[model samples]
Target: MLLCDTPNLVSSSEVIAGVSDHDALLAELRVDSRRPTPLPAMLPNWRRAPWPKLNDRLAEEMHAVLQINNLNDAWTAWKTTLVGCVSECVPSRKSRPKRRLLPWLDKKLKKMIKIKDELFAKWQVEKTLESRNLFETARRASQGAVRSRLSLPAPRAFPRRKAKRVENHGERRRQLAIHVLDAKSATGPDDVPAVLLKRCAKTLCPSLAHIFNLSLRACDLPTDWKCAAVTPIPKDGEKSDLRNNRPISVTSLVGKLLEKHVRNQLAGFLDTNKALPDNQHGFRERRSCTTMLLRTLDSWTAAIDKNSGGHVHAIFLDWANAFDKVPHQRLLSKLQHHGIDGAALEWLKNFLVGRSQFVRFGGARSEPCVVSSGVVQGSVLGPLLFNVYVSDLPAVVKTNLVQYADDCTIFREVTSQDDVDELQEDLALIDIWCVNNGMQLNAKKCVAMDLSRARQPRLPQYMIGGAVLEYVSTQRLLGVHIARDLRWNHHVDVQRKKAAQTLGFAARNLRGCTQRVKRMAYLTLVKP
Candidate 1:
C-alpha cells in the first residue's frame, strides 16, 4: 500500500545499507538529515507531478507541506515542478507584449516609485550637506577661528617679459671655456657655481647637473647672510675637541648637569641646613620607582572602573615638535631660574641649539645633510635633552594629570553639565600652556570618554569613538599573551611548558636544576 514510486528513494535506501560500520553509517545519516541530496537520487519521479504555474498559491502550499513533514525527497520534487512552471510562465522574448493596466493601480504604483526615487535623492543630498558642515566646523575649530581677524593681501601682478639676450659666438665660446675650467678646479661636484657646474657636467656627470639645478632653485633663505654663515664655535677649543673625540663618555657631562639641576630645584624641598647622609643614589632610585609605580597603578584603576560611581573623563595630549620648537631664550631663562649657571649653562645652550648632520642612502652611497633644530635622532644625549626640556609640565600639573614621557593623560570626575564644562576649560588651559611653550596638541589622537555606559551589569566600560571600550580580558603586553578566564589546570599546563623550556636551556648551558626547583622558577617567572 506504498504511495511513493520514486526509483531514487529506493536507491537512497540501498546507499544507506552499503555502509558496514555502525558508527560511520550513523555519522553519514546525521549529515544527510541536515541537508538535501542530489535531485536524481531524491526525486526520480519529479516530472510526474503537476507543475505549479506563475504566481500560483498552490505552489507555496505544496512547498510548505514538504518542509513541515521533513520530506527532503518531496521538497526536491516540488522544486523541479516550480522551476518548470516558471519557464512556462516566462514571456517569449521575440514577441512584443501589450501592457495590461488598471488606471487607478497604474497611477498609484507610478506615484509610489516617483516618491521613493525623490526621497532617495533628498536623503543623499542631506547626508552630503551634514558631512560638509561637520568638516567645516572641525576645520574652523582647529584654526582657532582666526579667519575673521586676518585679511589676505592681494597677489602681485607679474611685469611684461623682456626680450632674450642672444649671446655672440665668441661670448658663448668664452662661457663654455670658463665652465670647463670651473669643473676641473672644483673640489667636488657641489663646490662649483650652480650654473657653470650644470653646463660643464651635463654629459659625464648628469647627476651633478641635476643636483646643481636643485640647489639653484628658489628657496626660503635668511635675509641676513651674517646670521646664516657666522655661527659661534666653542671658546674652549681643546675641550670641544675632547667632547667630540669621546662621545661615549659624554654621559659624564649629562650626569653632572642633571645633578646640579636637581640640587638647585630641590634645595628648598630638601633639609639643606642638616648634613646629608651618603647612599642618596639608592634612596632616590627607590623613591622614583615607587612614586612612578603608584601613579601608574592609580591611572590604570581609574580608567577601568565604570560604576565605582564617578563621571570620569580621560584626555591624552600629544605635542607637535616638542623638542625642536623649544625657544632658546625661554629655555635659558627657565634653567637660570633653577640656578643652572656658568660653563654648564653655556654647554647646555650650545647642545640644544647646535646643528647636526644625518646621512641617508641615495642609491650608491650615504648623502649627508644638516638639520637646524632638535636633538639628533640616534645621538646618546637626545633622549636626556628631550626629557630635561619637558620635565616642567608634569611637575606643574602633577596634582591633576599623569604624564609618562610625551603622553599626558588628564582624568576628572564629572557628575553634572557644569563639571563637564569646567573639565573642558581646564583642558583648554593645558592646551594654551602647550602652545605658549612651542608645543601643539594633537586633537585627533586625544580621547575624551565617559565611563558610565556599560552593556553588562557588573562590567565597566569607556565610551571611545561612539563605542564601548572595555578592558581587555585577554591581551599581549611586552610579548607575553595572557589568557582570559585562567583556570587551575591551564595554569599548571603553562608552568609545565615553561619548566621544560628552562630545563632545556639550563642543560644547554651545563647548569643544574632539579625538577622541583625548575617548577618553582617557572612559577616565579610567569606570575599569572
Candidate 2:
C-alpha cells in the first residue's frame, strides 16, 4: 500500500513477522521517528514504593491514630497520616501501556485463506470465471472461523498464591489481609475509603498489622469494628418499597483487615480438620456453585447410566433469611463440635456477639439496633459461619446432599417406587433437623426436580414441613437450567435474550459515550 501524494517516500516493503504467513504482512511500518507519543502523567506504583522512607515517615506520625479510646477520630487521623506518608515517600513512574489482546486464530482458517489466495491467483493467470467462483466460495468458507471467534470466548485462568508457613504467621496474615483490600471497593460508614487505604498499604501495613495482632492477642475486637451502617438496596420491583430492598451492611473498612484474617484462619482450620462435609460447598476455597452443579450432575448421570434406565429425584430447599437466622449459641456449639476452642474459639465468639447495625437512608441514620442472632450481614465470615451453622444438615439421601451456602438439594437414583419413598423419608429427617436448629425451609419456595429422560405419568408427591413440594420439568438450580429431557435449548435461549437485552440497553443509553465505551456491548457479548 502506498500513500500516493506523500512527498518523502524513500522506500516501503513488507517484513517477515512470525505472526503472519509468507503471502501476508501483519505489521505496519511508518518512518515517523521524529514524532513520539508523549508519556502520560506518572502515577505512584505503590507495589514498588520505597519501604525505608515510607516506614520512617509512617512510624513518626502514625501515633496520632493509635488512641484506642476514640476510634472514630483515630481512624480519620489514620487515613490522613497514610495519605501524607504515601505522598511523601512513594515513587511515581510513567504508566505502562495496556497489553493488547491477540487471541489465537485457528489453523483451519489459515489453510482456507491460503487456498483462497491460490485460487484467486489461478483465476488472475488463466482469466477463468470458474476459478474466480472457487476463490469466492473459499472466502465465504472463512465465516465459520469469524463466528467461532466471536461466539466462543476462551476461559481465562488466573494463577493463585498460596500461603506458606513462616515464623510470624499472625504478622503474615495481617499483612496479606491489608494488602488484598479491593482498591475500587465502596467504603464503609467510617468514610475512609478502602481504595485510599490500599494505596497506602505499603506505608500503613506494619502499623495496621500491629493493631490487628493486638486484637487477636486479647481475643476481642473494638466496638467500632463490630458496628455497621446498613443500606437497603432494591433487590427487585419498585425502589420506593422498603420490602423490595434487602439490607446490605457495610462494616468498617479498617475492621475488614482484621475480619478477613480471622475468617482465613477459621476457614483454614475447618479445611485442615475436614470439619466441613463434602456436601457443603459454601464459601470454601476451590469450591463454587459451578463445581457443586457439576458434581451433582455428574453423579446423577453416572447413576442413570449404571442402572441402564434410572432417574434421579431431587428436592431443592431454600432457607428463609438463612444468613440472618443463624443463632449465636448454635453456631458456637457447632464450632466447638468441630474442635475450635480456647483462644481461637473465644476470638470467634467475640467476633460474632455484640454486633449492632443502623440503617442509613439519605442524610439521616436510624437508631442503632442490637442484633442477637445470625452472623454479620456483609462481613467476610458471614457465609462461612452460616455454612458451619448448617454443616450438620442431614445427608440421608443416596446422592449425599448437594449444598452451596443456604441452597440445599438431595437427590437419589429412583429404581422403584420404594426408592422415591426412601427419598421422602430423608426429607422428613431434614425437616426435623431444621426445626432443631432454629432454621426452617421455605417450604412454599421448595421445588422438586426430576433429571430423567422419560416423564412419569403420575409423579409422587414430596413433603417438607407438611407442605407438598411442586415438581417442575425444568428448574434452575444454582444458575444452570436443568431440564428433565436434558436439552440446553431453554438455557441457551434465555441467555441469548439476556445478552440481547443488555446490548440493546447499552446502545440506547450510551449514545453520548465515546466509541471506546460504546464498544462495551461487543465485550459484553464475549463476557458471557
- The 10 consecutive residues of candidate 1 with the worst lDDT sum are 221-230
Clashes (backbone N, CA, C under 3 Å), per candidate, total 0, 0
TM-scores for all candidates: the values are 0.34, 0.69
**Highest-scoring model, TM-score:** 2
lDDT, candidates in the order shown? 0.40, 0.75
Root-mean-square deviation per candidate: 38.2, 17.9
Tell me how far the alpha carbon of residue 68 in candidate 2 is from the true structure, in angstroms, after superposition.
Answer: 7.7
lDDT (Cα, 0-100) at 405 in candidate 1: 43
Q: In model 2, where do residues sit more than 4 Å from their true spots?
A: 1-58, 64-176, 238-241, 306-309, 395-399, 455-458, 507-520, 525-527
Give Cα distance to truth, residue 5, candidate 1, Å. 56
Tens digits of per-residue lDDT, candidate 2, 427-518, equal 98888888888987898989987777664533789999999999888888888888775678888888888888888877775554456555
Best by lDDT: 2
RMSD of 2: 17.9
